[model samples]
Target: MEVVVVTLAYTLTGRDTEIVSQLRTVSDTLQTAPGLTHLRSYRGRQKGGAYALFLCTWDSENSWRKAQEQYSPHKLLQEAHKRQELLVIDPLQWVMHYVWGYTRPLAAPTLAAIHLMSAPPEQEVLLQNGWRRTLQHHVQEPALAYAFLAHSTTPTTDEAHEGPVTVLFCFFSWSSQMERDLFYSEKQIRTMHAFSEQGSSVQILALEPL
Candidate 1:
């Protein structure tokens, strides 16, 4: 089983660049830590807040704890936090630990979906009515850790690539290949069949954190 460490931080109004730089440094340090398999950081589009995701492949929680104790990155982040308080308005930090208790390491790299729909104006309403419900139900299954929605005001790297007004980021944690296989066969595939019937255009990607 693998574990996920998710951290969320909000920066002061004008400190976005500085905070992101510090977070990049922390991520670089995490790259060298034992038990750490993947690390990625995301900046909120509207408010310039940030989210850091870490995927750790550990023999056990004890193994993760040992690695954390020896990793200077943890302490460095603590120091950064102290400095951040002076610059951030009301910074928020949250850490969530999830374990895939079934059998296999969760999926490698991981999966991401970027939807480019034709009906830009009606997309959000359609998604809120149906897609959200389907995903919420899908995530409640034991194999999934958690899933939620985030609205970002940030622009895509290329305006040409932008079609939809919002993005949906979903996270899934699986215990074993069998669990994921069953989920696709029994749930996701069927849901896809239904979603396809509704003529929703979506783009999906599989991503790896580094």
Candidate 2:
């Protein structure tokens, strides 16, 4: 079966406590939705709670779309929307192929990082290879939980935004936050830094399972 990760990055006009409560309601409602196997809710530490990422996994892209329509008019969702305005910065759907490690029977991770990256068209092949190799090395660690690497087949690009570029999504989960931070500060991440373009960067959003 194909695994798809749908990331909804949004900002709320209301307070964090209020927004999180609404998210919990959404999560509770999704329990009955078809095809949705996992739901992980996260707040972006990089922006001081101004942003949040909702990572959800489905059996396939088609099933996910069907669930969207089915759940669009749910009363729980309508109630959440009424409490606060959700300004979605990016609604990205990634069809991820397994590079290394096992990610099944999904559990709440202690900490997870969501990365959204853009690479020049010319470097697409190299970019994918670099990410795969780096991920493979990390998978060897017993503390590493799971890692997924995917690129957007249909990325949003316009004249105002940069022209059509390869969008890469990397999600990693660690046993603890300290290990996660160390992995980035040490040599492993530096190797990736040297392998890709200078402009290629990822936002390290600290995560929690809803």
Candidate 3:
């Protein structure tokens, strides 16, 4: 699957009307979009800093590109941007971060989390390999629906001017949020935490399907 992670940092705090309306419009169109297997929306909770994430998976990169040019949501979003009703801190930010297809097909009942990692260039491979190994145990868990990793092709804002930085994206899905929380709280997940600590920094986004 080709996953496109579109993150928008809004200027306002808490449910801004225009942003919510725009997102609702996009989510509605995404439900019936061709080639789109899944669409998860996330609203950031930071008090002073507010943002949202739209994680979308498609059959291929070509399909995604086609949607950008022809899809209704894309057209709506473009119009919103033009009117300054929907402002994103990084409008050009888009990442292709799913390297492999999902372990299970996308479904409405599943819940997922996205992890954004950055490490020194030299430690990139090590971080990727270690994290992959750490997730092996969870892959077979009955509650886990799917999981995959992706590396960023461009430098993230935080890494600009720093030494070569690699962005690592990983997504883990479970049948439900309750099941995911239960499984994630286990002591064994600490091992994955340790592996991630090897990187310079990491940010995790718990995603909800719209």
Candidate 4:
């Protein structure tokens, strides 16, 4: 399975509540789309705005293309796009990230790490250290694919729930569920578990490409 993760960042021009409500509607529509596997909407905590994250899974890139073609004429998507303009300050550009299934490409692994933090303002150093250690040293699985960290700026708008201070986004690819299982159970993952205890809270999700 392969998937495309699309992320959009929007700056709200008015009240956070109104902006979030529209985002929820868009999410609802996306959830019903044929090729969409997962759709998550986030409101910026430090920077007052909205960030929309969606994962569209496919058997191949060709499958994704077919799905896109089908969605282009979708009335719900069109309506949502219009509503988005009211809430966003700038033009929306779709940012695309690719995920390759490990089963097909045995030589490559798909891995992703996302860290959400809500803690003491002074813990910035600790947070950075945790990210570096986990992404660089801990997840040593040779099949490891790609990794990245993302954070919002100041203003910190409340969309659905108040946003976290920072969010770390990482991606990795693997051949099979068994391999992922092994990697997660490894000592490095244990070390990551211990490191994460320092945060006020955290959320982890396992996702498959569409």
Candidate 5:
């Protein structure tokens, strides 16, 4: 399957400019990497400092794996140095990183929402079942131009719940905000309960492509 790398950085203290610049500088090479289909960066702000979201999509798992082989020791060392610089800039910042299944690609998407939450390890199957069922049901919605259901792999964390964390990001697009809210409103009454019941807490992050 194709892979969509999702990375969110929050609580960045006061060094948002430098951090974003560094991130862009380091990420520039991915544009020419094999299998790289799309690369985008977004910036937002909340209470702490600033927020940055990076969405990188590859053609397939094998493509991403093969691309990793090109990372040399010198390149790794340079990335490490950049990380150290980030640490020095914002010691209290925290980041959430995950690679999710990229089943659907964006097509001039105008709006998006990232659903973040953690669920019990035992509910992985149920959660996955919910995604399949929901996507199947919503495929015909006229207002929903696109839909993507993605989950984390290998990464297991207990940050928001008692068990493993599953970050489900649903990137959507509609002709208008009214249409967008209407679809979600209808969905909340239907599928949201079906899937959200498996997780403890949920946060929906609104996004725009930068």
Candidate 6:
């Protein structure tokens, strides 16, 4: 697929409703970009108050780069983030992926999760394949709406440079958190934990729409 999705997830000192209000000006300007297909926002809760995510779908990497040069929402948000209005718990773990697989979710996703893992360049293949098998288990549940794994390609071009792949991200959406819980048993939970142990900087962050 030619589509590329860039995700920016961060913990907000306040709710995204306020941020949404602030984004009106930026969103209006962004909508006119030719390569930008969609720009969406999401919010979720855990121990902290709320976390926000912005998902941007672009026609291709080149298109996304051009938009960045002209008007980068990421930079605008980053400035707000530095001011503590939309702070990121971990700046390094943001999600960005190219659409290697595609399947529309039957139902609107009320909740979502992004699995992040990274290791040395030599170990990227092991982590990538392992996560694919892990994602298969997640999609088996009836509540699972849709899931996709990142294409195992280096940044810039798919032609591949001297460096090997070193990180991978996979996303999955659920109809609801309750349905997600009902589908997992103690055995299943154990299996999930087992997969998490295979790589470093592994994180399974829970999320919901804004």
Best by lDDT: 3
Runs of candidate 1 exceeding 4 Å displacement: 47-59, 70-75, 83-210
List lDDT for all candidates, in order.
0.45, 0.61, 0.64, 0.46, 0.55, 0.57
> Candidate 5 on 7-47: residue-level lDDT in tens?
66542456656766665654666566788787765555555
Better of 4 and 6 by lDDT: 6
What are the clashing pairs of model 6? 42-210, 43-210
lDDT of 4 at 117: 43
Please identify model 3 stretches exceeding 4 Å from their true place: 1-5, 14-17, 28-38, 62-79, 100-111, 154-161
Per-residue lDDT of model 4, residues 1-210, tens digit only: 454444434445556666567656655665666756545444443344444434333445555566665442233334665765533433322223332122232354333334444344345346656656665664444435434443322323223235434333344445566666765778766676566656545545444332
**RMSD score of candidate 6 (Å):** 5.4
> Residues 1-210, candidate 2, lDDT per residue (tens digit)?
545554555556547777777777677666677887776666654544455555556777777668776542233444566667654443434444434345624444578876666666556557777878877766566345666776665555533236666667777887777767777876867778666545464445566665
Q: Give candidate 4's TM-score.
A: 0.44
Model 5: ten consecutive residues of lowest lDDT? 88-97
Q: What does the lDDT come to for candidate 1? A: 0.45
RMSD for all candidates, in order, please.
Answer: 12.6, 3.8, 3.8, 11.5, 5.3, 5.4
Please, what is the TM-score per model?
A: 0.41, 0.77, 0.72, 0.44, 0.68, 0.70
lDDT of 5 at 159: 57
Q: 59-124, model 3: which lDDT tens digit per residue?
A: 777787777665534454566667665654434345565554356556444577767777776676
- Give the winner by lDDT: 5 or 6: 6
Indicate the TM-score of model 3: 0.72
Candidate 6 stretches greater than 4 Å from native: 1-5, 14-17, 23-30, 79-84, 88-105, 134-142, 151-165, 182-193
Worst 10 residues of 6 by lDDT: 155-164
Name the weakest run of 10 consecutive residues (lDDT summed) in model 1.
94-103
lDDT of 1 by residue, 151-185 (tens): 22222232433564433333443444565556557
Worst 10 residues of 3 by lDDT: 6-15
